[model samples]
Target: MAMEEKTPVTLGHRSRTLTAEEIEKLSDDKETVSDFKQRKLEEEAKKHWDKFYMRNETRFFKDRHWTTREFEELLGQDFELPSKATGDQPTLLEVGCGVGNMIVPLIEEGSAFRFLACDFSPRAVALLKENPMFSKGSHRAFVCDMTTSQLLEEVPRESVDIVTMIFMLSAISPEKMPTVINNVFSVLRPGGMVLFRDYGLYDQAQLRFKRGHKLRENFYARQDGTRAFYFSEEVVKSLFESAGFQTKENSYVTRSTINRKEGIDVPRIFVQSKFVKPQARYLMQFADGV
Candidate 1:
């Protein structure tokens, strides 16, 4: 079957889904990394990410200024405590906060929520703490391996009001995803929420992998030694729902990434979703379609 090609329209424009033939072709490579190598990749995931931040510093990823534009729930009143309230400021924890790409922007945007950010890479955490904004607000940056460590040690259980997993969870091995999800769930308040975005199945990055890059089904070890697992909407829904989160929103988010200098334009697929940790007796519903 001939793969139907899509022409780029405009940056950030919605993109069409890949046909089955395209998906099959992209994943057809039979060769995969050896089990011994796969184990090494898993064991050194942190070291690779640390080296990544060490080399790239704060320059690799752009500031995620578009976060509020895409997930407006960040600015919702739920996270903004009443001016007169005596309680501690509402807390938002960012898991896998690399160099504060998401943290710095939200702070700059005049957000009122307190921030608690953690990353597996110690170097990334150090860089984030060095950012001028880190000391200016109610923000804390720390090093944590959520897959193997308990977030409760760093913060009180159910103390967080929101957790953002932007472009971060894909780096972990699939077997540990549940552990990470449960860690996030443990720290969230009863009515808290998780705002998630990560690479999706058939994303251009996924299709670009060649033979031997496949660590396992839908998972790959990049040349940098950092791993990524492309997600499906069903996988997103199932992982969170099974961890006791109620799904509020879960779907594929598509856009075209273009490079005019190289005359290259390609569709990028990402899964963006919202899942809520329900209150014992009630589940909060937003009128704005959170």
Candidate 2:
């Protein structure tokens, strides 16, 4: 049987200018940035992604399929849309939104939502800006390192109604995970929602890591050397709750795929979650300093 052709998706938006601090930090990280050995590995991975888009640039998934089909069903609920019902459009932020995979499709669906997308890679952001599907009026894209930068500085606080983190959070190191989560929380309005999906424990991709590829703990190196961390259900809850979100839905999804070459079947696990911030407020107590 012939292999099914993989269709590439077009998801593009405009790129934002990096701040001076971001430029300086990127420049000073010479070991990671300029080291010939590491640079070669990084370049190889980047080249792979570039080639992936070059070949499959026009295809896009029509909806937030993973979240809609998995988490929404498990929780027996639906997204609580804004109540104002105004002519003004709702705003959405897609962190680690690669090439507009989710954002572009949402826009094309004719929903009255504006989107802002961010990825740490300059190459990804550049391709997003160049794509004809990127509409400046309704969408914006930027190269942002969420772990170190201030999200509110670029995007106004309490301005976004929905934030999507599809298959993106597992890519960051565990230490930096809090920073990314907090940044997302700071920008979301009270009663806003966050939709998340990422790899779960023992997925084929996790088990495939070789010995030396272990970066730290559960984190593993991909073929292109980009790092990924798998999350347990408890860990996912802690990460979001610690950032002041209330987990409305959390569950593990198991799916099987045929391994034709091995003449067998394989199973994959994905953790899907929907978390919301409560409408109630907590009082802050300040201590006096001498």
lDDT string for model 1 (76-188, tens) is: 74343222244767788999999998989889888878899999999999999889988777689889999875677998888888899998889988889999999998888
Per-residue lDDT of model 2, residues 30-94, tens digit only: 33223454445444644655555565553543345344355442222466554334434578788
Each prediction's Cα lDDT score? 0.85, 0.69
Number of the top-ranking candidate, with TM-score as the measure: 1
Give the lDDT of residue 254 in candidate 2. Answer: 72
Q: Which numbered prediction scores highest in lDDT against the true structure?
A: 1
* Superposed model 1: Cα runs more than 4 Å off: 1-24, 77-86, 281-290
Alpha carbon deviation, residue 33, candidate 1 (Å)? 0.9
Residue pairs in clash, model 2? 8-56, 8-59, 9-59, 11-99
Could you tell me the TM-score of candidate 1? 0.87
Clashing pairs in 1: none
What does candidate 1 score in Cα RMSD to the true structure? Answer: 7.4
